[model samples]
Target: MHPNKLRAFWAARQGLLECDTHLSPETVLEQTGWARSVGGVGPYLTLFTRAGLTRPAIDRAVAQLQIHELPSARGCTYVVPRSDFALALRCSQGFGDAAEVQTAKKHLGVTDAELDRLGRNVLDALAGGALDPAALKDRLGDLVRNLGPEGKKRGVTTTLPLVLGSLQTAGEIRRQPIGGRLDQQRYAYARWADSPLPEFTLDAAAADVELARHFFRWSGPASLAHFQAFSGLGVKASKAAVAPLGLLPVSADSPLLALPEDLDALRAFVPPETPVYRLVASVDALLLLRRDLALLLDPADVPRVQQIGGLQDLPSHAIVDRGRLVGLWEYDPEREDIAWTSFVRPDAALRAEVERTAAMIREHLGDARSFSLDSPESRKPRIAALRAG
Candidate 1:
C-alpha cells in the first residue's frame, strides 16, 4: 500500500467509473483505469459525462456489460444504474416541482388523480430534501395500489415498480440498507438513471450469478461473500454467476484482497504512510464495493452518516486519496466540479497533491459551473431541522 499504488488504484477506479464507454467485463478489465469499485451507477454517469458520452449511449454500454437476465410476471429486470426514477422525473420536468410531478405522471401513464398524488409526493420530497424510505412508505401508505383487477391495473402505479426494477437489474438503481421498516426498507432513488434503458428483464439465479461476475470484475479480488453483498444475490447465485469469470487464484495472504488489476491499482494509489480521506458515506453506496464498506469506514460511522446529511447532501462524486477524502464534488446538471477542501493541517506536499487532484476534477467538468457549494445562509426551517437532528 505505497502512495504510488494507492494513487494508481484511485486513478484507475476513477477513470473506469468516469468512462462513458460501454464496457464488457473483459474490456473493463483491460482498461488500466478500471477498478472493482463501480457497482453503483451514479459515479458511472459522472465517468460517462466527463467523457462526453450521452445517456442513451451509456445505457447501451451498460447493457453490453450484462451477462444474465431474470424472469418475472411483471417482466421486471435488474441492472446497474439501478433506477432512473429521479432522472426520469428530471427528464420530464428538468428538476423538482409540482409541474415536474405532472410530467412524471404522463411519463408513467398515470391519471390526473395519480399525478396529483405523485405531485404531493414530489413536493414533500423537495421540502424534506431527502426521502427516508420507511418514513415515505408510511407517508404514502394506503396510497400504493398493487397491480391487479380490483384496486390494481396494468397502469402507471403498477408499471412504475417494474420500471424501477428494470433499472435495479441494470445496475442503475442499487438496493441498500435503510434501517427502516420493511415496506420502507427498500426505497428507490437514482444517480445513474441518465443512462436510460430500452428494456428490463429479471435475473434468475443463473443470470444473477453472471451479473455477480460483472460486479466482481468491476470491484473484485473481493470475497464471494462480498460479491453476494454487492450484487444482492444469494450465496448460490453469486457463486454461480462468477464461476465462469476465470478469476486468478494468486495467493492466500493479504487481508485486503483485490482483483489483480485492482490490486495493482491499489498498490499504485494507496500510500502506506497516509490514507486519510473524508469520503461521504452515501457516495460510498455508489463507489465502495457494497460488501467491503467496513474496510473503508468505521463501522460506527455508518448509521450516523447515513441518517444525517447523507440523503440531503447530493452524492459527493469525488475520489478518496490514500484514504482521506480530499475533494468536494457536485453534479449540478451537466457540470461536474470537484473542489479541493482545506485539509486538516495539510503539509506542503499534501497541499500540492490536493491541488493536482482538484485540477483534474475541474478539467473533467469543463464549463458547467451552474452549481455552487458555498455554505448557505442558515434559513429558519433548515436551522430548526439541523438542531433537531
Candidate 2:
C-alpha cells in the first residue's frame, strides 16, 4: 500500500466500526468490518463510545457496510427488533421507486390509491409506540385485510414485507420463527434492542457518540459521505454527529480523519502496508469503504458469492490480507464447522493462517463438531420456509 492508501485504509476500516446501528458489540462485529475482531460486546461498545460516535452516524456507517439482497416478501412480513420498524418507517417516506411502491402495496394488502393512507398508518403506528410486531399485527390486521382487491394486492400485503426489509436494513429488527411445521411460513418476532423506536436525536449524544469514534479509528482516510452511507444516518446528519469528535489533522489535509491517540499508535506500525488478518461478515464495516463492492471483489464473481440468498451463496465470510479481501469462508452452524474455500490459491503461510482461523471458530462454537461439506444433510444448515403472508 502507498503511504497515502495505508492512511486511507486505516481510517476507512475504523470509521466503519464507529457507525451507529445500536447493535451489541458482538452483533456489530457480525454486522460490520473485521467480523469477530474481538470478544464481548461490553468492552467493544465501551471503547467505541468512549472514542467518539453519535447514534445516527453509527447507524449510517453500519448501513453503508452491508451488501443486502432485498428480503423475501412472505417470510419478511414482520420486522424484528422494534427500532428497525421506526427507522424503516422514517426512511421509506421519501422513496418512490416503482418496485418499492409495488412491494409496499403487496405487504400491506392495499390498492394503489390507498398507498398514501397505508403509509400514514404505518407512520402513525410508529409514532404511537406500537413497537411490537405482534401488537402491530393485531392493530393493523383489520386495515390490511379491508383494503380492496388492489388494496389487498397493492397496499397491505405488498407494504408489509417492504416495511420489514426496511426495518431490517435500519438494524431495528430481524426475521425469526413464529411456529408451524419446519417448512411453513410461520414466523414471528424477537427484539434485539431496548429502544424500539429510532432516536432521530441520537445523531448527537447517546450511543451515536461511541459509534462515531469506532469509525474514526477504523476508517480515517474517508469522507463524511462514506461515513453517512456506512452508518445510515444520512449525509448531513452524519457530518453533524461526527463534527464534535475532532480529528488528528494528519499532514496532507487529505479527506482522512483519525483519532489523536491512534495517530501515535499507527506511527509504530508499517504505515499503509502493515499485514493484518481480518474475518469480516457480509454486512461488515469495510463494505462502506467503497460504494461499489468491486473495489474489493471481481465483478464476475460477486453475484455468485453475494447473491443475497444466504451465507452459502455469498462470500459472507472473507479474509482480509493487509487490508485487501483475499478469500472467503462459510460456516455450517448445525455442524459447527468452518469451511475455507479461497478464490486465490494459498501458499504455506496463508494456508496455515486459514487453518488457525478455523481452529478459532471451532473453539468459539464449543461442543460443536467440525464436519466436511460432504457431511450428511443433518450436518448442513437447515433451510426453513414459512407460510405466505
Candidate 3:
C-alpha cells in the first residue's frame, strides 16, 4: 500500500476523520484495544479527540465502571472497556517476567511464600469495600509496614504494590478513580467483580489470536514486529497469534500485514489533496499504532522528533497536517494556555483552522485562559524563520 494512502486509512480507522455518534467511549476503547493511561491525561484527550466525547461524559463512564484502567499489553496501564477487561487482564497474566519478580523480592526482602501471604491479606482487606492505597496500607498494618530500606528509598510505605501488581495482572482486583476527574491518578482498590467481567473462556492461544485480530482491526497494514512490540509477545507467539487471521502482505520491502477484509479498503484509500490538521494527544493511537518511524515522519526531521540515540521518542502531542506530522503542541496548566511550534509554514486557511482548533481546546479546557505560539528549544529556529517572513 502507498504510505500516504496507508496514513489516511489509518486516520479513518482511528476515528480521526469523523466521530461516529454510535461509538461510545467504551466502544472506542474496545475497538482501539486500549488507550495509553500512564500519565492519566492521555486517555482522556484521546477519547475527547477521537470520539468527540465531553469530559463529563467520559468521567461518568469511568465512574460507573463502564470503562476501567488496568495493566495490559506491554505491562502498561491502559483505559480498557469493561467488556474487554477480563480478556485483557487474562492475556496480561504471566506478564511479570522473572526479572521483575526477582527485583520485587530483592527490594522487599520477601520470599515467595511471604508474597503469597501478603496477596491473601490484601484481598481480605478489600473484600468488604473499596480502599485507596493509603487506607489499604493502614488496614494491612504490620504485614506491609516495613518494606525494607530499599522500599523506603523508593518512597513506598509498604510492599503492597508488589502484591497488588500481581493481583491486578491476574485479574483479581482493579483500580477505581478516586475523584471524577479524567486526569486524576489517585485511585482506590476494588475487587474485580465477576458479574462485570466477561466469561469468555479462551485459552492463551485463542486469546492471543483475538488480541491480534483487534490489533490489526485498529492498527492494520502493520508488520509482525509491530504486533510483537505493541503486545509484548515473543516473535514466535506473535506469528502464531496472527497466523490464523490470514493477513495479506502489503509489500516485500516493508513486509507490512493487513487484515484480509481491509485489503480492498486500503487499496481504495487516497490522501486528501487539501491540507487537514488535527491536534493529537501525546500517546495518540495513530502515532502509537505503528513502530516504524520512516512511515510517519520525514528522514530529515527524524532527529527533531526523536531523542539522541533513541529511535522512538515522539513529542508529547503532535500537530498533523493531512497525513503528515507538521508540528508539536503541549498544554500548560499553570498558564492555562496551549504552546505550539510548527515545522511547516501554514497558509492563511490552515492558520485559521489552527486558530479554530485552539479555540476548541480553550473551550474544552473549561477555565483555561489563553493560547500561545512560542516554540520549544528544538523548533525555535523554525518558528523564528516563519515570523521572519
Candidate 4:
C-alpha cells in the first residue's frame, strides 16, 4: 500500500481520526489492544486523545474494575480492560520475569526460595485488606528484614518491590488505585479477586493466535517484525501465531500485513487534505508501531529529537500532523502549560492548525495557562530563536 494510505489506515484503526465516543473507556482500551502506561500517565492521556475520555471517567472505570493495569506485552505495564486481562496476562508469560529475577538475585542476593516465601507472605498480608507500597513494606518488615548486606548495599527497600512484582507476575495479586487522580501512580496491592487467571491448559498456540489477532485488528498494515517487536514474541513463535489468522498483505511489494476483512477499507483510505493535528503522548501506540525513526520524523530533525544523553532514550511526546511527527511537546507541571518545539517551519495553514491544537490541549488540561514553544533553559538560545520567528 502507499505510505500515506497505510498511515491513514493506521490512524483510523487506532481511533485517532474517527473515534467512537459512545464506547466506554474500558471498551476503547480493549479494542486498541491495551494502552501503555509505564510513564504513569500515558494510558490516561491516550484515552483522552483517542476516546475523548476525561480523567474523572477514567478514574471511575479503574476504581470499578472495569479496567485494570498489569504488566503485559514486552513486560511493560498497560491499562487493559478487565475482560481481556486473562488473555493479556497469558500472552505475557515467560517474557521478562527471568531477567527481572536474575537482576534481583544479583543486586539483592534474593534466592528463589526466599522469593517463594516472600510471595506467600505477601498474599497473606494483603488477604485482609489493600496496602500501598509503604504500608505493605511496614507490614512485611519482619519478613524481609534479613535480606542481608547485599540488600542493604543495593538499598534494602528494593526487596519489597521485587517481591511485589514476583507476586503480580504469578497472578497472585494486582494493583489497586490509591488516589482519585487517573494520572496518579500510587497503588495498593490487592488479591486478584475479579477472576482467576486462566490455567496453562488453555492451549498456548490458540492463545498466541488470539493475541496476534487482537494486535493486528488494532494495529494492522503492520509486518510480522512489527508484531514481534511489539509483542516480544520470537520470530518462530510470531510466525506460528499469525499462521492461522490468514492475514492479507497490504500490497504485493509491501511487507505490511492486514486483516483480510480490512483490505478493501484500507485500499480506499485517503489521507486528509487538510492538516490533522494530535498531541500524542510519549511512547504512544502509533509512535511505537514502528521503530524506524525516519518514517515518523524528518531525517534532518532526527538528531535534534533524541534525548539529551543518547538516541536510546525516549523521544519527548510529540505533536503529529497527518501521521508525520512535526514537533515535540510536554506538560510542565510547574508552569502549568504545554511546552513545545516545532522541528519544521510552519506555513500559514499549519500555524493556524498548531494554534488550534494548542488551545484544545490547554482546555483539556483545565489548569494549563497557555502553550509555549520557548525553552525553559536559558542556554537553549536556538529554541528561543525559533519561537521569535
Q: Identify the leading candidate in terms of lDDT.
A: 3
Task: Tell me how many clashing residue pairs each candidate has.
Answer: 58, 84, 1, 0
Give the 10-residue window scoring lowest on summed lDDT in candidate 2: 72-81
lDDT by residue (228-255, candidate 3, tens digit) is 9888899899999999999998766667
Residue range 1-389, candidate 4, lDDT tens digits: 45566666677777777546687888887766688765345676678667667667887898888888887776767788877777767766666665666766777667888877878888899999889988887888867745666655655545677777767766778887677444446688888865547454545578788878888988867889988888888899999999998898877887888888888787777788866667676567777766545556556767766643233334356677766767765555444445566766666755664455455546554322111222335313433333343
RMSD of each: 13.5, 11.4, 4.4, 4.4
Question: Residue 351 in candidate 1 has what lDDT?
Answer: 51
The lDDT of model 3 is: 0.71
Better model by lDDT: candidate 1 vs candidate 2: 2
| Candidate that scores best on TM-score | 3
Model 3 residue 40 CA deviation in Å: 3.7
Whole-model lDDT per candidate: 0.38, 0.42, 0.71, 0.69
Per-residue lDDT of 1-389 in model 2, one digit per residue for the tens?
24434533453444322335454433433223332111112112222422322223333333432311112111222111222333333333333334564554455444655544544465566664434565666667755434346545444433455455445444455444332111123344333353334555442233444456655655544566566654556666676667778765555755655677756655554433433444444334454344434445544546644653432222234555554555655545454555555555566756665555445445432312222122225433421110010
Candidate 1, after superposition: displacement of residue 242 in Å? 3.1
Query: What RMSD does model 2 have?
Result: 11.4
Total backbone clashes of model 3?
1
Query: Which candidate do you rate higher for lDDT, 3 or 4?
Result: 3
Task: List ranges where model 4 is wrong by over 4 Å.
Answer: 103-109, 145-158, 196-201, 297-314, 343-389
